[model samples]
Target: EAAAPRQSVVRRVAASSELVQNVAELAGIFSCLEEAFMVYSTRKAIAIDELMEGSRVSSVVEDVFYVLRKCARRAVATGDSDCACSVVNHVCAVLSQRLYVELEMRVGQIGRNKERTLDLTREAQYEGLMEALAEQWPMVEGSDDAVNTSSASALGASAMDLSTVSLGSAGPGGVDHSVLGDGSGGMSSTISAEAAFWCLSVNNVEAAADNVATVKATLEEEVRLVFDDELESAKLASCIAELDTVRNDFKKRLQTGMTKLCASLSPRLRSALGVMDGASAIVKYELTEAEFADNDGFNPFVHEFLGALERILAPHAAVLSPALFRTMVFKVAGYLAKQIK
Candidate 1:
C-alpha cells in the first residue's frame, strides 16, 4: 500500500512538471515570434520610399499584411488559443503604433507642404500685380522724370512688403519654409512624389480595412475548425474582435485622410475660382447687344476658369480611388455653389 501511494504521488508530480515545461516552451516561441515581427515590420516601414509607384495600395502595406497573416496562421496552427491571441495582439500593436502612425505623418507633411506652395504662388501673383500697377500708373507727383522715380520707389516698397511677409510666414504646425522649395529641380520631384505618396496612403488605408475583414473571416473559419472546445472557440472569438477594432480604426483614418486631401485641394480650386470674381464684375454692368453676341455669348472667363479647374483636378483622377475622387468632386461642387451664392 505504501509503495502504490508513493508511485501515484510521483506520477502526479511528473504530469505537473510536463505541463509547466510545455507552457514555458510555448511562451518562448511566442516571445521569439513577437520579436521577429517587430523587426520585420520596422524594417519594412523604414524601407518604404515616398516616390515608389503604386496604384491601389502601397507595396509596404501589402507586404506587412502578408507577413502578419502568415504569422497569425502559424500561431493558429499550433492549436493553442493563447498563442493565437498573443499573435493577434502583437499585430494590432504594430499596426496602431507603427504603420498607421507613419502613414498619418506623411499625409500631414504633404498637407502642410501643399499649403505652403499655394501661399508662395499667391505671393508671386501679388508681386506681379504690384509691378504691373506701378508700370501702368507711375504714381507721379511732379514730372515725367519724377514718374519713373516714384514708380521705382513704389516697386521697391512692394518688394519689401513681399519680403517681410515671406520671411515672417510659417505654415500650419510651423513647418519649415525650406520644404516648400529649395530652388532645385529635385525639390519639385520630391514634392510631386510626396503628393503621390499621400494619395497612395489614402488608398492603402481603404485597402487595409478590406484586408483586415478578409483576415478576420479567414481566421474565424480556421479557429472554428481547429478549436473544438467551446472555451477555446470563445477565446478565439474575443481575439478576433481585436481585428474588428483595428478595421474600424483603418476606416476612420481613411475618412480623415480623404477629408484632409479635399481640404488641401480646395485652396487651389479657390484660387482658380478667383477668376469668377472678375467675371462677376464684368457682368455687373449692362452689356451692349454686340458684346452679348460676341463669341456666341460664351463668357471667356468661365471657359478659362473651367480649363484651369480641369487642369488642377486631372492628375488626381489617376491617383485617387474612385470613391475618393467622387468625394472630391462633390465637395468641390458644394464649395463652388457656396462661393457663387
Candidate 2:
C-alpha cells in the first residue's frame, strides 16, 4: 500500500527524459541535494552480509564510478559543463532514490539477522552514490579490465571509458585496470584483488572433495600391498614411513588444488568470500557407519571419503541445475571404483 509513491517515482525516472533534463539544469544545487540524500539513506549502518550480497554491490559501484568519471572527462574534453552537470544531476536524482529505497530495505532486514554485528550500511550508500553515476551514463554495456573474458563481457568496459577511469587518466585516486588481466589471462599480481573469491574457493572445495576419497583409497591400497602379512620390524618401519610420506603429500596436493582454483578467478573478481571453506564441512554420506564397518577395512575408507565429499558439495545442492553436481559425484565414484584395482 505504501510503495505506490516510490513506484511512481521509479516510473517517472525511467520514462520521463524531461524530468531528468530539468534536474540537470539545477546541477549547481545538486551538491546540496546529494548531501541530503546521503544523510537520509545512511541514517543507519549496513551489515557485511548485505554489502557483500553475491558481490553485486561491488560490481555495480565499480561500474558507476567508471562511467561517471568518464562522463566528467568527456564533458571537460568537449568543454560542456552543463551536459556533464545534467548527467550527474540526473543520475543523482534517479539513483539516489534507488539507494534510499535499498537502504530502507536493509533497515528492515536488520532486525531479521540478530547475529550481524558489522555495519557497512554507510559504505553501501557511498557505493550507491557511485552506482548512481554509472546508472546515468548511457552505455550499451559495462566492463571490468580486472577480470578475464567473463568480467570483460560482464563489465563490457573499453579502454576509453570505464578502463580510463580506473587507470586514473582523468584524475587522482584512479585504479589501474591493467592489473586486472595479463594477456595470458592470469590476472597476474591483481588476482588477489578480485571480489568473486567464492568461485575459486568453491572450485577448490569441489576438487578436494572429489579427489580426497580416491587418494586415500589408493594410498591405503599401496600400504596394504606393501605390508601384506605381518612383516619384520625393519620392513614394518619402512612401510609406515612410506604411508606417512604419502599422507603428507596428499594433504599438500589438496591445498595446492584449492590455491589453483582461487588463482583461476583472480582476474574476474578482485576478492572472494571464504564460503567454500564452510561449505566443505557440510557433507552428507549415503552409507551408515555400521554398514561401512561391516565392509571391513576398505569399506570404512571409501564410506568416510564419500561422506566428506558429499558435505563439501552440499552448498551447491540447491542450485537450479544439478546436472554438473551429479556429474561430479559420478566421476568421483567411478574413479574410486576404478582405483580398487
Candidate 3:
C-alpha cells in the first residue's frame, strides 16, 4: 500500500520508464509532436522561400507572420523553449535586418489582407516589436530544459495567443532516470547512473516533444498522402503499411543502431557496462514485431539502448552543450524525403 503513492510519483518522473508501458507511451507522444513540428516548419519555410523569391502576395506576409506566431506558441506549448526562442528571434531578426521599410514602400498592399495592417517599416516600430518581445519573453514560459532537440522542433507556437505553454514552467526537471558510466576509469557506475538520470530528467520535456513531433509529422503526412489527388489511392494506402514497417524496423533496430553510434564514439559504452563481449550476441538480428512480442531482448537490449543513450547525450554533458550540428538541414531533408515522390 505504501508503494502506491511512490509508484505514482515514479510514474510522474520524466524519462524514467518503470516498464514497457511507460517507454512505449513516451515514444508515442514524442513521435506525434515531432511530426506536427515538421508540418509547421515545412510550411513556414516554403512561405518564406516564396516571398524571398520575389513572389508578391500581400497576404503572404500576414500568413507568414501568422505562422510564426503559431510556431512560437507551438514551441512553448510543446515544451521546447529553444524553438520558441529561435522563432521569436528569427522573426525579430528578419524584420530588423531586412527591408520592412523597402517592402512597405514597394510591396505595398496588393489585395485586402489583414497583414497589410503591419506597416513594420519604421525603425521605431521595429525597435518597439523587439522591445515588446523582450519584455514578453520572460512571460512566454518556455521549457526549462535546453537539451531536448525534439522540443526545439515542435515549438508549440500559435498566432498571437500562446496560452497553452508557459514561458518557463517546471517540467521533467526532477524526474528519475536510468544512468550508466563512460569507460574512463575515473568515474564509478553509480556516478554514471546518477548522471544519466539527471540528463534524462532535464531533457524530458524536449524528448517527449520530439517524439510528439515525429508522430504528428507521420500521421499528418500520411493523411495528406491519403487525401492527395496527386497520389494514386492504391499507392497512397501503402503509407500506412510503410508506417508499420518503419515502426517495427525502428523498434528492432533502436538498441543496435544506438550501439553502432556509440561504438563510433570514444571511451566505448560496452566496456563501461562490462558487457563488451555481449555486443555480438546482443545484435544477432533486427527486431521484428514477433520478436518484440516474445519478450526476449528486454534485459540485454535495454542495457545497450541506455548505453547508446549515454553517448547521444555525451556532447551535451558540458555546462555549455554543443551537440547535433546541422540538425535543421536534416529536418529539411527529412521533410522532402517524406513527400510522395
Q: Best candidate, TM-score-wise?
A: 1
Off by over 4 Å in 2: 1-57, 113-341
Model 1 bad stretches (over 4 Å): 1-24, 48-54, 114-191, 279-305
- List the candidate numbers ranked by TM-score, top first: 1, 2, 3
Model 2 agreement with the true structure over 41-104: per-residue lDDT tens digits: 3332222222232322323333333343343333323322444334334333333344324333
- Please, what is the whole-model Cα lDDT of each candidate in the order they appear? 0.58, 0.33, 0.32
lDDT tens digits by residue: candidate 3, 1-341:
99999877875774364674564555456545644554455455433432111111223334434443454344334333233334334433333233132232222221112233444434333233223322323221122221221221111111111111122222332211222232121111111211222222222222222333354354344445334434333333343234343334323333232232222222232232223234334433566787676545344434443443333333323210112112222332243334312
Question: Which digits, one per residue and each the tens of the lDDT, describe model 1 over residues 45-156?
Answer: 5464222333445566777777778887878888877778888778777777777775665455435422333355434432332233223222211111211112212101
Worst 10 residues of 1 by lDDT: 182-191
* lDDT for predicted candidate 1 compared with the true structure: 0.58
Q: TM-score for each prediction?
A: 0.64, 0.19, 0.18
Q: How many residue pairs collide in each prediction?
A: 0, 21, 42
Q: What count of clashes does model 2 give?
A: 21
Mind sharing the TM-score for model 3?
Answer: 0.18
